[model samples]
Target chain A: MGRLSDRAAFEQYAAQAEQRWETLWSGDRWVISVGISECSIAKGALETYRHLELLLSDGHIPAVLRRVGCAGWCFAEPFVEIKLPGQPPIVYGWVTTDRVPDLLDALRRGELRPEWALGVRAGESWQGIPALRDHPFLRSQRRLLLEQAGIIDPESIDDYIATGGYRAFLKALFEMTPEEVVNEVKTSNLRGRGGAGFPTGIKWESGRRTPAWPKYVVVNSHEGEPNVFKDRRLLETNPHLVLEGLLIGCYALETPHGYNYIGGEHALALRRFQKAVEQAYELGLLGDNILGSGFSCHVRVRTGGGAYICGEGSALMYAIMGQRGQPRTKPPRSVEEGLWKRPTVLNNTETFASIPAIIRNGGSWYAALGTKESTGTKLVTMQGPVRYLGVAEIELGMPMRQLIFEVFGGLRDGYRFKGVQTGGVSAGPLREEELDVPVDFDALTPLGAMLGSGGFVVFDDTVCAVDFARYLVAFSRYESCGKCTPCRLGTPALVEILDRIRHGFGRPEDLDVIQYASKHIIDLSLCGLGQVAPMPLLGMLERFREEFIEHITERRCRAGVCPMTAAAPIAS
Target chain B: MEPTKSGQRVDLEPLRRVLEERFRPRDYREAQELVVGACQEAQRLFGWVPPEAAQLIAEHLGVTTNRIYGLLTFYADFRTEPPGRHFLWICHGAACYVAGAGRLVEFLQERYGITGQGTTPDGALTVHVFNGCLGVCDLAPFAQLDHHEYVGRLNLERLQALIAELQGEAQTEAADGSTE
Candidate 1:
């Protein structure tokens, strides 16, 4: 424990909190935490809260209502979990304001509606519903970063601290040396989850070796990845973990200054993170001489200007320096020469959020969890026809088949899984035959795919591969920073050819042009955005070549998605 | 380069002073920070960075106007022209596309005669130029009215209702011109 007794007091308080769990289950106080998200808010979560408030004012309902982040079951939002004394907490899904009175009445009667009951947790079953973890969607998930999600008040640092939040930082400060911390991370075998899978330990060691005054650490919370929400959810639910990780990185790198670059459009996430920062400062976890350990660090939250390129390391540094969001040429990577021409360390939100756990439990323990190459769990955002639409943290190397069919309950009605796109718009599609592929970075790399930001979307048979290719291609084209010629010109040309192919005007020669443009774009682009610009088109061409040929020869889209520009096929 | 107006030349002191205060420039080394400060101030104060405002920031920070303009243009959030009373952002992410966000975009374009990013002729709304993803993939086909407020699961009827609400609010604001 530190001199302030803060750590000791917190540990005691956490113990007390754990002890109070029995009280919560067997006492008079009833707690209800609604899983709140942008989706839940739109689904009238606020309305439900207001209805509860009205009930409370009427002196009818005798329970406290609290807001929590997404419970990883977004399909069930607005989710509500009710805890009554001496009984298992019953969770309800798809709850609405109109159902509040009935729910409260049932709760008053010590009963729950079976149809609405999703799960119960008290080492007992209720209405045929099993434990929350027993749900197929959550069974295989290894919740590390999201352990406290939908359970704690994110705005309350005391809640976070009482749950053993900053103990890892304290441990890093008092118990271990900076190099020891780096070695521990190395021992954990934690690779960067920021698509690249670079070793976190190596990045830190390099930054440590470089002697520079005022070295910098940056938290890349600018999650502009097309369909990924893991970072946003983590920030919204438990920002302190990320902050702790950033502090750890700072300590390891001996950097005094840090920056958290968040997307400007992420209003809720930004608000929650800002609140956490303020509370951390108030609790002395941040600011000068943090925890009286003589470790001083300052973290500034910089709102990104809504540029996707800013998510790139060098491009992000430029954005922070108030220049155009553009990437720098490599040979001297960001670790050596970064923001303000100083050695800098940058890690994604998920990579940073996992630090506390790695430090608390020995790094070797973490190393033993996942596969040989990729250690620890990965957060994946599942979309498309999956039954459950939410973020889940699963042990890496889990087969995509089990992730989609078993966990997400497979495709929805009238949909057969035709293909799945992992790693956002950049990575190529994996056909149904390739569903058994393990979702680790190295495993997917040989197939011309990467676990790029872990945005996985499943497509049905009805989905036009050509049209979907255009959609992903369009995202890359729109987001390309026009600094480089390959991305600037090549992506547009790719788009033009794709547009023509989709609209039934593609010539036999267009396919050759596409392959040519794609190869050149990957080879000549200045940055990742440009380099990956041709991926969607090329990936679709490689995997779904027949779809393109159908559009060209038959002048008929098998999925009926493309519009016909002319009645007859174009001259060969 | 933009020609300076007489009034702007005479009254550049207010904007210049604000830029200086925002940047806290110790010397020319801190010129880069001024670009962000100027852009943020312009968006917050004037709703857009006019060429004159960029010039003011440039002079105050001891940098060229092109430098400041380069940043404003490069960033998607910054706008050079004034926006209407309200702004709406309809996400076009992969999830949104799968959930029929294209229909919503087409609906907005055909009914309201607005395509991409444009201000309504009535000056009631200015939609962004592109239907960029706003990171709310869970709520596929979600839109942000103003900046912070999210409205999700949008359909034609729901979008019409939202537009009506916006138009009504704008009318009320116009009627009570004294209230900003």
Candidate 2:
């Protein structure tokens, strides 16, 4: 009964943290955790948390209330997890302030009622609630990056240490050479998760090989993509995991300086990450002679000014340098000449987050998870009208249909399954029949369905193909940085053409003009942003030509989305 | 608010202190790197970059006033002109588009009497079509109120209520700044 009194002591730092974790979860006291990321906070998570804390703060229930990161369950947000002594945790969703007292009362009575609970997680079912592994949304996902989300107090370095966070970095720092670390990542075959799918190991190898001193590591945490939120979620929930991964990268490259370029809009994430960095510094995990290993690494958090282009490699560096966040033409590609024209290791937040797991287990162990070409699990955020909408980590080779139908429970009751916008809004929509295709970057790119950042914006059948394509083209036109002529001019031209077609002014020859201009923009644009801008228009033109033809010839939007009657776009 | 000429005055004492304390640069080239950060800090303090404030930053950073002006003009985050007291941003990304943000945009434009980015005639509120996705598509058809609080699951009715609420707020916050 005295679980707290039976502490097994250890001298190692990670082992000491493990002991702390064991004591916390060893049924010494009841635990209450609330999801507190931006999404949940918007839905009154703070109010619910405050109410619950007030109720339990007196210690009358022998319970402790903790603030943890969100579990990517946006639909049922303001969720609260209650765990009794010797019982698995039960997550109650849609928990308002009014429900806090009732939940506390139930916990106080020593009988957790599961009628309002989402699921239970202790590797088995408890009460009437299903185990998390068996839950439909979680069943298909093998969560690695999000393994500790919602369970650990993200602001607490102790919780991170208990979960074996820096063991991988410690291993890399003490045992392995920088070459071995790069080789392990290369062996893991981890590609960039930030849309491009570049081989991360190869980039690391180059960063390692570049004969430059004072090498820098910049983790691009700026999520400028239209619909991707996985990076923010990672930063919020498992920031230490990403931090540990960053340390591994820095140690591998012998880098002394690191910068986390975060989006300014992500205030909560930035605050939490800044706190994590602070805690690590205090614990001797960061800064000179970390844990007395004679190796020093310092990480500073930098903020972006909400520029979409700043998420690009070169543009991100420029933004770090406090510029206008514009991209430059490549050739000295970041590895060779980056960050003040010095050799730099630039990778996405998710790419760095995957390092610890690869190093902890072998690189081959990480490689065995997904398809031969696209190995390792990917963090995918599904948006739109899906019933089970949220961010999730899924193995790379899973067919898109399983995620759409089986994992997410198809569209909501009234909506029909339309095409899924693979990658972000920048990539083209995959046809309904194309759902059978694997989500591998190479497998889908040939069909113009690159899994850019793994954000799938699913649309319902009610949306018109032409109008939707026109909107995507218009967004590209709006976000074009204007460094080059083709993207700056071509996006506007395509938008004008598409807008004309939607507004019943398109000529038959406009299609040919769009094709020619789109091809030129793809070929002539300076950066990847320009090259990818016309993808939706090009993809829609190829797959949904009939829809455009209908819009042009019959002057009709079959889905009733556009005016199609010579009416202005802003008509009330 | 932007500096209105012939002229309403803005004190540069506080900004000068900030530049000295936080943004003291080593050289001319490194000072160029501080352009965005300086402008960002200035925008936070004043809500929008006043030309005098830009000039002060220019002289402090040892760069030309035009350089700071170029940065302020280029980034979406910076606004050269004065902003309304209350800001309403509609998400214009793909998810919001599918969720009927365009309808909200049209309604907002018609009601506010401006498109793209503009303040109301009464100077109570500013409505801007946010350039990128605010990344909370879970609440598709969302808007950020004054930058942090998100008003999601929005319809025309809720947006009207919000605008009316903000206008009421600004009405109390008059030109003389008597209301606390």
Candidate 1: which stretches are off by over 4 Å? A1-27, A568-572, B1-38, B41-47, B50-65, B106-115, B129-132, B155-180
List A-chain TM-scores for all predictions: 0.96, 0.96
Candidate of highest TM-score = 2
How many backbone clashes are present in model 2?
1
* Tens-digit lDDT string for candidate 1 (A237-264): 8888898899888888776788898887
Q: Model 2 off-target regions past 4 Å?
A: A1-11, A567-572, B1-7, B11-34, B59-62, B175-180
- Docking category of candidate 1: acceptable
Candidate 2: tens digits of C-alpha lDDT, residues B89-123: 78876678778887888787677666667888887
Q: iRMS for model 2?
A: 1.9
Cα lDDT tens digits for candidate 2, A458-544 = 888788888888778777777788889999999999888888888887779999998899899999999998898889888887778
